[model samples]
Target: MTMPHKTIPESNHAKPVNLRIREDVRVLIDRAAKIRGKTRSDFMIDAAYRAAEDTLLDQTLVKVDAESYQQFLDILDRPPSGAGFERLMNAPKPWQG
Candidate 1:
């Protein structure tokens, strides 16, 4: 039995982006899009989105050695100190007056 395909919902796209590519690159993209049964725009949008996500994630994700990771956890566990505690204690509350 053939199952129905799930498609992304259509949204109002008001922005226009102009892309410049070599003819050979365009042909390659067209061929790949045809093979995947997607229009060139659909394929490019999906590929661009994936690339953008990976770029952002690469910047945000971090790897640390076990000792450094333990140090990080230790810092988080440390209590607020000195000036910060004094400020909190002296700060005026709206409920007081």
Candidate 2:
């Protein structure tokens, strides 16, 4: 007599994706990954992360109009000095006064 057959359980989750790339790009990715001693996925993830960070930093960086920027540069170049500096530094403290 034949033994009873048991069916294997089937998974409903979809398999992870695989990307098909051009041969030259694939070679380039492989070379870069090898140079860094990382897998292609790790290299790509790191590169993407860096690109996002750079984009965000560029966006967040403060930019001023030419006139305003020049004024800022002038102020920085000609910082106050002499008695003004001394008075500001030697000003009486609220607790002392």
Q: What Cα-based lDDT does every candidate model obtain?
A: 0.86, 0.79
For 19-52, candidate 1 gives per-residue lDDT tens digits of 9999999999999999979998888877887788
Instruction: Please provide TM-scores, in order, for all candidate models, with all chains considered together.
Output: 0.53, 0.47
Name the regions of candidate 1 deviating beyond 4 angstroms. 1-9, 61-97
For 30-94, candidate 2 gives per-residue lDDT tens digits of 99999978788767766766788779988896878999999998999996899989899899988
Q: What's the residue-level lDDT of 63 in candidate 1?
A: 86
| TM-score for candidate 2 | 0.47
